[model samples]
Target: MSEQADLKRTPLWDAHRRLGARMVPFGGWDMPVQYATGILAEAKAVRTTAGLFDVSHMGRLEVHGPTAREALESLTPNVIGKLALKKGHYTLFLNERGGVIDDLIVYCQEPNLYKLIVNASNTEKDCAWIQSHLPAGSVLTNRTPDTALLALQGPLAVTIMAAAGAPEASEIRRFERVAVRLFNNPAWAMRTGYTGEDGFEIQCSATSAENLWNALLRVAGPNLVPCGLGARDVLRIEAAYPLYGHEIDDDCNPWEAGLGWVLKKTEGFIGAEALARLKESQARQLVGLTMETRSVARQGATVLAGDRPCGEVVSGTFSPNVNASIALAYVDRDVTDETLTVESGGRRQNAARTPLPFVDLPVARKKKPAGLTSTASL
Candidate 1:
C-alpha cells in the first residue's frame, strides 16, 4: 500500500478520521473502509434504519449543449435521448469490443444538459473518453473537485431528509433529482442509491461539505449511522449491483454480467455491433449462487460442476440479511439449474443456483409523472 501522503482525499477525510474510521487506499484515494462500529453493524443499520456514507470520492460531471444528448448516446449503451428531465437511470459505458468500461448513473437535468455520476476508480478514464467523443460546441465540466457527495440511505432516509429542512427531498421519487437548500446550502438530492434501499444521494459544494455533513448528523440524530466503503460494498453485493473491476470490467460485456436490459439493441452506439453479435451468439453468462455450507466463496474462486470447473466467482460475501453465503459468478451459457461447487482453502463446498440479488430490493423505480416540474428550486 502507498503512503497516506501520496493518496488523494475527499473533503470529509478529517471527519472520518475523527470518527475512528479504518482508512485504506481505494482507487488512488485514502478512504474509510469501515468505522469503529464495524462493517456488519454499519450494513445492518442501512437495512433496518438509515446510514450516511461519504461518497464524495465518486466523480461528477456536467454536460450540456444542443448535441449533448446525442453525443452521450453514441458512447453508452443506454438511450440518452429517451431520458426525461430530472430523471436518472443506471447505464454502462462500453469499449470498442463491447466490454464494460464502467457502470454509472446518467441524470437528465435539462433537455440538453445532463449530470453524470461515475465510479471513483474510472473517473479519469471515463472523463477522457467522454471528452474525446464529445461533439463540437458541447460542454463538459468535471465537477468532482468542486462537489461533495453524501448518501443518506435506508427506509428512514426520507424522514431524516425531511427533518433536516429539506422537505422537498421526501417528495423526490425514485430516479428523480431535485436541487434544494440543505442546511441553507445549495445541494442536489437524487432519489437514487446503490444500497437497494430507498435513499437519496446528496451533492453539495465542497466548501460546505463538512457543515452539510455535520448538520445532517445533527438532524438525523440517533437514526444516523456513519458507514464506510466496506459496508457500502456488502450492501451493493446483496443488491446484486455490479462493481467496476470486479463483476464487470474492460474485459467483460453487459451480457456476461446479466445487465442486458441496459443495452438498447436498435440504437447503434459504440460497440453496438459487438453487443449484437454477442446477443446472437451468446457465450458465458453471469449468475447468482447460494453456498450450501458456511464457507464463503471469495473472488476468483473457481466454480465447479462435479469435477469440472465451469465458472469463476466475481463477488461473494456472507450475507447478513440472508444469513447465508451468496455470490455472483460467470458460468458457461449452457450451464443452468445444476448443482455447483466453489473451492475455498482447498475445500470444495456445495453451492446451488439462485436468483440475482440475494435479497429483494426494498424500493422499485417509480413511473414518471405526466407533468414534470421544469424548475428546481435551489
Candidate 2:
C-alpha cells in the first residue's frame, strides 16, 4: 500500500484502469505495462496498422536564453548550434569522464528556446546536471509535470492525424516539430517515434491529454490499438534502440556500443577528451544475438565463446516480430565466433550472432504501386 501510494500516476491513469490495463511501477510512476489486447498484439499492431501510447512519463524541459545555443553546444556530443528552428536531433549528455549522463533529444523550438525530452528515470539527474551547466542568464524549466505526451505510431498514423483534427501533423517532416491542432486543441507534434515505425509524438497540456487520447482513438476507429510499456519495450528492442541502463550507460562506451554516429564532431563536447583517451581500452562491441531455443536471455546473463566467458547480455526479450528471443550484448572485439551461448538459470542456450535490428524497419521495406499486387494466383 505504501509503495503504491508513493508512485506517481500520469494524467491518463484512470483512463488506463478503465481500459483494463495492467499497472506496474516504472521509473517511480505507476504505468500500464500492457492492456487487455496483450503485449504481443499491441506490438504487432504498431508494426502493422497503428498503436497509441501514453508516454507522458518522459521528462520534458525547456531552456531559454540568448546563450542557450552556446550552452547546449558545450554539453552534447552532437552539433546543436546548427539546428534550425523546429528541428530536433538525437544527442547525448556525458560526464567529464566520458560516461553518459543521459541520451536525449534536443529540439530548437525558437531562436532562444530549446525543448529537451529526457528518459523518465534520468529526469531529475538530467535537470540538475543541465541546470548547473547553463550560462548565467539562461533558464531551465521542467515542463514534465504539466505536459502529457502521446505517441501515435504505425503506417496508418499519418492518415489518422488529419481525421484527428491535426492535418498539419501529416506534413511535418521527420525530426521536425510543429505547433498543430489535436481535436481542435493546440498541441506540439513531432514526426518522431522510438518504435522504428512512421509516427508522431504529440505533446499537449495535461488537462487536454485524456480528451486528445480519446479523440484520436475515436477517429482511428479499429486501425489503432492502445499499447502499453511492455509492447513499447519489445518494439524498441527489436529495433535495436538502446535503453538507458541497458545498452548504453555510465560504464558503456559510445564508440564500441555502435553509437559513434551520435558523435558528429568528436572533439567538441564535454567528454571528447576522455573518449579519445579511452577508446582503445574499451574493446567490447555491442552485438545482437538470437536464441536457438525458446529460452530468453536477460540482462547480466553471461555470454560464452565455446567455454570462455566473453561478454554479458545487456538487454533481451522474446520479439514477436522476429519470432525468437533476441538479445543485445557486449563481447570482446577480438572474439570472432558467431555461435555463442548464454548461461542463465543453470542452463546454457545457444545463440547465434545476428545483425542489429532483428526486424527490418518499416521505412526500409519495399512498397508497391497503389494498384499493384504481388503476382496473383494466375
Q: For every model shown, what is its TM-score relative to the native structure? A: 0.93, 0.95
Query: lDDT (CA) for every model shown?
Result: 0.87, 0.90
RMSD, candidate 2, Å: 4.1
How would you encode candidate 1's per-residue C-alpha lDDT over 214-323 as one tens digit per residue? 88888887788999998998899999989998889998878778888898644568888787776767678888899998678889999987788888999888787888
Best by TM-score: 2
Clashing pairs in model 2, backbone N/Cα/C closer than 3 A: none
Strongest candidate by lDDT: 2
Cα shift from native, residue 78, model 2 (Å): 0.4
lDDT per residue for candidate 2 within 24-58, as digits (tens), equals 99998999999999999999999999999999999
| TM value for model 2 | 0.95
Of candidate 2, the 10-residue stretch with the lowest lDDT total is: 369-378
